[model samples]
Target chain A: MKEFQYKNPTRATWAEDYSFLNNDLDNSKLEGDKNKKSNLKVTDLNLYIHQHHILKNVSLEIPDNKITCIIGPSGCGKSTLLKTFNRLIDDTEGIRYDGSIWVDDVDIFDKKTEITDIRKKMGLLSQRPCPLPMSIYDNITFGCKLHGIRNKKRLAEIVEEQLKAVGLWEEVKDRLHAPASKLSIGQQQRLCLARGLAVEPEFILADEATSALDPISSKHIEELFVELKKDYAIILVTHTLRQALRIADHVIFMYLGKVIEAGPADEIFNNPKEELTRKYLEGAFS
Target chain B: MNRILKNKIAAGMMFSLTLASISLVVLIGMGLYLKSAPIFKEHSLWELISSADWQPSSGKFGFLPFIGGTLWITGIAVILALPVALLTSIFLSEHSKPYVKKWIFPALDILAGIPSVVYGVWGILLVVPWVSEVLAPHFVEYATGYSTLSGGIVLGVMILPLLISLFVEIFAAVPRDLRDAALSLGATRWQTSKLVILRKTLPGLLAAVMLAISRAFGETIAVLMVCGNIPLLPHSLFDSCYPLPALIANNYGEMLSVPMYESALMLAAFFLFIVVLIFNTSSRAVIYKLERKFQ
Candidate 1:
């Protein structure tokens, strides 16, 4: 419960260090400039979930190798926006969308985006830890098998490497055959993180990945995210302002399905811009 | 009485009821063993188990043929029923809508409630003639009213609804999370069913099948009507057969010789008791295995 402010570096501090903030506030201009370079972009994105227009004309550049944190209040369409990237929301009953989500220079919604390959490129983690009722080794190696990586030796190596990467290798090395759910909640969450990362995805989307864990677990996940961002660009949706401030390199503040504020994490947290963003940071409304 | 005394009284009542039921079961078992001690002494366990001759009048009472017939019929019934029942269960659990499930499930319950006598009568009147006239020409060439296949098939139908409904309940009890989790892992719908859902609920499904088999094993009237009550080993589906229950029912009325009759009946009952007991114990063991696995 702390009050935080995000300065619109585009509006203020238009100096040498903050020159990147001069991109247009509207998404169309931002996308045109960014998409000519990167492979993924949200172009004039609008997401209407059921009767509620969850995201209204929201767009952002999800750069190839940079972490983007979607920070917002509950039900602000942060997770909804992330789900749209992989067309997961399409599985739901009554979702209607009118926008373009392009991945790897191809419009993903263009009737040609194979969900399997799209999902292969982008691994996802939910808020709760979901290690399948399988062995620790198998849980980590499951997605690899799905992508047709059947070489057992290679799978064993990937399991070891991913577990080590998530800092869970030492704790579970000897008991790789043990059921993944037998681990503590913290360990289970890390196990799930390892599962996602084992797929070797270029982009990892975590929807409040550590929200259901204890503070210690949350801290470990945050550290893992920082380490992970070095390799895979992360799109994390979190309600925790402190979490966003701690790890997010770039922050997009969403409210009522709209981007209330967007800027670098440091500028967004330390300075003032939108009143809704400020109030949200101050714990005015969760 | 104080609260503690009241609680103790309640506990004691439950303990007494449990004690009574267990005692009754033990007494019945003991009584059967004691009553059949003459047969066990005269005929060795191997003779009782392996001998095929079932002539009780001259005291050459080998219950093996009846036991074998019982087993073969039950096995055939289960083999026939299991696939049909399992497929029905899967359809009900996975494919049927809520309204269809609600109505279809109760229809299955009504099938369960239909008496064995009705099934027996139906098997004789409706099923027997159909098999003789329609199915016999291509296969048996001289089909009779009583055959193992007819008995087993009718018995299978009788137990099919029970097995299907129990299977549906078992499969339905599988957690939605297990399905969703597998699906989200990029597994196709069929893969999810085959891998996660089926694997998780295998123990329950196994228990259901075992119970159905147990029911099929002990069923009497239906088997009696269709089994063409010959005491000989059936070579094919068209041959006459005699399962234990049919034998017991056949001989019980005209069995005037005391020791011969008593011993035959006791041996048959003993055989059934052992079979049912084994099935029940295995069912419990499966449940225990499932619990331990989850734990």
Candidate 2:
């Protein structure tokens, strides 16, 4: 019920600022503010999986406080690109990336970067909901406990706040102590989102978070993401162009592991610059 | 018509096989019960189990000392072996390098395959002498060459390979996505293992430990050689004691010459079988509950 502000300027702002909504129509006006700090900057990114190049030389600046959807067909490196933001791809053996991804003015790929700290700054939702094998309350507070929040009242409040943020509190308010695996697939994904948000991440990196959910649940999640972008930058990887058009403020179309075209959603949809982008948007092939 | 006849034949054969195995166990249990019935008729069950005296000439057939000795030695072995096995399993499943796993796995398999008699010979040559010479003089006063401590140490070593293998398999069976989910939340590797993996596989771990305990309870030659078979309640770890299996192994040959001795020994065997049955059933129950929870 009280307003909360981030003490650190580099952290995502919790208060909703809707000024970006007014400038959504004009692509040139938004692009003119290039001097302003972006949430993330990728420079000459190239990813290789066991000597096979997966992503070609790619560079893009993700604007702050916006929903940027990376849309592409299967095996187009969209998920790989999304994973690189939180360094989840590092878990794969023989994965080599020659690029610099800067988040909050720090190079995440730098040798001196603390991976735990970098991951804490970004929340990740995988394709399927993989809740920790625990009670719902414990799932939400796992990251908080790892970060040294030991107070019971504080933990209970955090569970409520995060679950409410993802619209899971009302549905699961009475069964907070139930096992997370007992929930439906839709509820489990929402609980995963709540668990991710409990860490108070500045960015939400979702890889097909709604692909496994029903249409109603997917609609709820899409609406939640639209509201979330006002406080945190959301970078999503989705194969559905309809979902992208419904939620994405900025869109990047990738083909064969390369970014073909990227700009404001309206501009890319109305006036096509590249033939591949136009064909892909027109449903020639997915 | 031929296919239906074949199917009926196969079904009848499978049913008969199942019945044969169940009847075999029932027949063996009935034989043991009949052999031990004379002792139970002569003395009260409580007195046979709780009385401490074992004077055969005076016709006192107490079994408390053997039961106590078995429990003591098995408890010590479990305490000594469990932590080591858990650590070894965690290393093998999560932390081992590929080359290390390649060598250690076969070595562990070989250890598991070694005969109990070989372990008994090895313990007599090495572990018994070390306990008597080095440990007894320093830690205990007026201790003998054979002790519960020595036997427990040997049994602990014998069960380690089995426990480690079971634990490693359980840890390996944890789904990869569960671990990735934990790590993506910025948890350290140890935290993920302790908080997520361990919790998920707890029932399996318990089953493994129960299996090891059952094996230790029935272990014979290795325990016999080191336990010193004194047929008395041990006052300390350094004191000599006679476990139930050792008592049966040592005195079964003389059963025909003595009256009621054979029946008492049969009763001991029956008691041991019951204990093992309880352990196995509980372990299976835990696994069953775990599977049902997940489903």
Candidate 3:
């Protein structure tokens, strides 16, 4: 129910500049200097899964090279909204959406668009730890193979770099040829992080990646997110308010499928504008 | 004090029942081994193991042809059934819709429950006639016999449901996370099934295949009905065959002639027992190894 277009100012560099007008709230006014560096824009987004509205008229701007954390209660549509960024919900059965999700000025819902390119541009790490039934080395190179980079030396180097980037190379460097399932739970989660970064995606979506991990492992993943935000924009959906405060630069607080309040993490945590947001921060409700 | 002793007595009674249930097989095995000793002594293990020709009426009994026949039929049947059953399993596990799977899966379960005697009757009246009358003449020219090929084909069909159902169960037990991980990495659906799921499930698949092979070897009625029950070594698939189970079935009742006939038949029983015992032991060993490895 919305229109999307691209504006090309240079031959190689492109930007997605979106504007929306509504009688309920004028979103175009929120489109300030911040919107100029946005890689993706969500406007009037609505999602229905089996006749249950999961997201309702949501609009937000995801800036470049920043970690945007979505904090909400369980079943509050944070993960569902994350799935829309790369169209991961397309494979979900009996799901439908009425929204325009734009990436670099291209409407992702266009029939001519391929999911592989979108998936390649964005890496998603799910809540549960999943390592392939393969060697740790092969897990890192699986993305390279999918993208048809067959050079052996380059792949080896990339695997090493990504492993080192996630701070797992020291523990697993000696056992890189071992099956990833052989690693401990904390180690496997870090291996999955390295696997995600191996593809060199511009954006990373983590759906509560540290929920199943211990405190030390949780801190390690938060540190990795800090290091990774320098080169990639990361969108994290977490039910833990403390987790969001620890890692996020910007936080979007959603309750019942609508954005309750969103701002810089410091302001949202120290001085929440909405009552539900304040109650959620105080642990009155999840 | 009396009530506590009664409860302990009941617990001990149940424990003994569980122990006896497993010990029953060991008792039967020991009894069979002892009963086989006289036959082994009269027919000198060399004669039974070396000679290929078996004619009880002439007082010469050898187990080579029957053992060889069992191996040949099982080998051929596995060759025919394994690929088809595995492919069907893959389809059921990964491709079929939920409603279709619900229907098809129960149909396979029913196939596993079908009686072996019914399979025998079908092989004799249906498969043997079809092979001899329809296919043999075109290929062999002088073929007037129901061949080992017919028997093996019938046995293969009989074991198909068993192999397929076990394969489906194992394939379904593979973790969905493994499949999702592969698919999320940009591997196509088929690639995910082939490379990740199938590779991870290989040890279980191999165990299923071995169990199927043991079942096929121990099968008596179906192979006996269709194999033509000849006593000579089969040089070609077109020739009639006599396997160990078929020999046990065919000669056990007709050995009223000399007392040595009983000994010879008992010797064949021992051979069949040893083969089955070896298979069961090896299957358990391999499955144990796989369980430890995967865990």
lDDT value, residue A259 of candidate 3: 90
Native-vs-model 1 lDDT?
Answer: 0.78
**TM-score of A-chain in each prediction?**
0.85, 0.86, 0.85
For all candidates, state DockQ relative to the true structure.
0.28, 0.45, 0.34
Strongest candidate by lDDT: 2
By DockQ, the candidates rank as 2, 3, 1
Candidate 1 lDDT by residue in tens digits, B84-158 = 987788777776656788798789889989999999988999778887888878886688757787888889999
Collision count for each candidate, in order:
3, 0, 0
Q: Which pairs of residues collide in candidate 2?
A: none
CA displacement after TM-score superposition, residue A246 of candidate 1 (Å): 2.2
Segments in model 3 whose C-alpha atoms lie over 4 Å from true places:
A1-61, A83-113, A284-286, B1-10, B133-139, B291-295
lDDT on C-alpha atoms for all candidate structures: 0.78, 0.86, 0.79
Quote the positional error of residue B142 for candidate 3 in Å: 3.3
Per prediction, fnat is 0.14, 0.57, 0.31
In terms of lDDT, the poorest run of 10 residues in model 2 chain B is B286-295
TM-score of each: 0.81, 0.88, 0.85
